[model samples]
Target: MAIPGAVGASIVDYTTGFPVATTGAAPNNDHEAAAAGTADVVQAATSRSLYVSAVPHDLLEDLIITTAGGYHLLRPVQTDFDSRLVLYVWLDRAQGNLAVARLRMQKLADELIAT
Candidate 1:
């Protein structure tokens, strides 16, 4: 998100749970590292749940999923065929809204940002 007071934001695919895009302090910080680590943790620990964990987010695919402190949102998108994908986002708990952020990600994903 490009909102003011935003600390950091990232798009992760829960299917392969990893960071796709990150805006803010990820370059120097371990934000991306933590994201990738969490994804692996989810995959190894909760693979049976509705939460589909992914590999490194940069590897790529059709899912857009997100994970933030106090929030984990998954927005699935549809293509012309039987394919399906989700949009993922990560935001800080104190500064982000689970509902509005999900909506925004849904809008972005609808525009084919999931790919």
Candidate 2:
């Protein structure tokens, strides 16, 4: 939530590559596509981690994708309900602070577990 120039945010199911909840704006206003695409990104990162570490349970805490125009922060949310959930935030790089966004995303993940 502290992410500056945030265009949108969503809670997605990585297993199904589908969005469970979404807020704010999405590129082209296409939340579904964004969710699915981002989920693929998460899946790829996880696969790479597994290949290198040889541990399927070795999960990535967060992944940052920096584009020419903005930053995409993907944070995995592990809760009692499900571990396949992820939080995605799209931020304008010119205005966004990566460190602050990461901290906020961690905090949000904690709060999500409490609920």
Candidate 3:
């Protein structure tokens, strides 16, 4: 399924803000992606007005993001990651949400198998 206005998408490790894997977006080297994701998380982690808070380091796992032009939706996906990592998604602010986007990502993640 195609999400409208979905320009860029990637799975970033919260520990470092890097891409575990990416699609529908420009290619990012693992180190660069990790750094970017980490930076985004750090940027958000310090904000008091964010709709949601970062997972505690002890609880950090996977994360997700969905955004458009006006909103950026983010969520942690490692409820089961044993506090090690997370998936961070970045969406265009105009087309993202805090609740629904992650559910969709969760659905997709559920279908993927670890090799």
Candidate 4:
């Protein structure tokens, strides 16, 4: 994975605020809570985007949050299964490359949708 120092990854359903699947280490070792929190982050970002005239788009591609220790990437999955789904990836700031991680995440999302 190009997402260096990845701590965890998960597929979450924002509509229901639940994790569909998860892998790796999640915050507090709780994937379910992490997924739910990720859904909230996605919802807030999407809602804010609607009010911004700069980029008027119905679809939310991704949301990135950088902390002192790591980076969080929230990618909404455009799948036949559910549009409300999102892919969440956590990476260490020291090792992860944001640009590469974004591309890799997109690829992961595409593969997920295809399956």
Q: Write the per-residue lDDT of candidate 4 for residues 1-115, one digit (tens) a residue.
A: 5467788899999877799889999988999999889988877777667633465555667889999999999998886654688999999899888998999999999988687
Give the CA lDDT, 0 to 100, for residue 82 in model 4. Answer: 40
For each of the candidates, give the backbone clash count.
12, 0, 27, 0
Per-model C-alpha lDDT, please? 0.51, 0.84, 0.47, 0.85
Which candidate's TM-score is highest? Answer: 4
Model 2 global lDDT (CA atoms, 0 to 1): 0.84
Candidate 1 lDDT, 27-94, residue by residue in tens? 24765674665466445444554433354343222233344443444444455775323444445667
Q: Which segments of model 3 are wrong by more than 4 Å?
A: 1-4, 26-70, 79-83, 92-100, 112-115
Candidate 2 structure quality by residue, lDDT tens digits, 1-115: 5566787899999878898999998767998998999889888877667643666566578989999988899998988664689999998889888888888888887887887
- Judge candidate 1 against the unseen true structure and give its global Cα lDDT, from 0 to 1: 0.51
Q: Which 10-residue span in candidate 3 carries the lowest summed lDDT?
A: 59-68
lDDT by residue (1-115, candidate 3, tens digit) is: 3333344555556555665666654324354554475547655654453433444444323334333343333345443445323343445556655455556656655444342
Task: List candidate 1 segments past 4 Å from native.
Answer: 2-6, 12-20, 26-28, 41-46, 50-88, 112-115
After best superposition, candidate 2 residue 16: deviation in angstroms?
Answer: 1.1
TM-score of each: 0.46, 0.87, 0.47, 0.87
Candidate 2 local lDDT, residue 93:
83
Model 1: residue 30 alpha-carbon error in angstroms: 1.2
